[model samples]
Target: MECPNKEKNLNRCNCSYPSCSRKGLCCECLHYHLRNRQLPACCFPDDVEKTYDRSFEKFAELVMKGKI
Candidate 1:
């Protein structure tokens, strides 16, 4: 089934990974990243997201640094 809010979701999506199949699919994106021991790009700031370091450790470090 198609996501009802795909277009809207895309507007707020900060993922910079080109050709990502889960671009506008929030649930799938979250699941895929979590399964790989990482967080989705949208969880981080745009600059940070661009680094493609979505690991849980990175997110924690950002949080600790009050940058999230």
Candidate 2:
């Protein structure tokens, strides 16, 4: 399904995955990441996001460190 907010969402999406098809599709990206036991890159800061470590563990660690 075509995302109606694709353009708008892309403006705020921080996903740095070079060829991500869901870059501008928040719903699809969220579902795909959750299914894989991960969070979308948008959940992370750019520095952390670039590492591509979107796991729940990573998020928890960041939260504990007050980095999120």
1-68: candidate 1 lDDT, tens digit per residue: 99999999999999999999999999999999999999999999999999999999999999999998
Candidate 2's C-alpha lDDT? 0.95
Candidate 1 Cα errors over 4 Å, as ranges: none
The models' CA-based lDDT, in order, is 0.97, 0.95
Best by lDDT: 1
lDDT string for model 2 (1-68, tens) is 79999999999999998899998999999999999999999899999999999999999999999998
**Model 2, stretches more than 4 Å misplaced?**
none
| Residue pairs with backbone overlap in model 2 | none
- Clashes counted in candidate 1 amount to 0
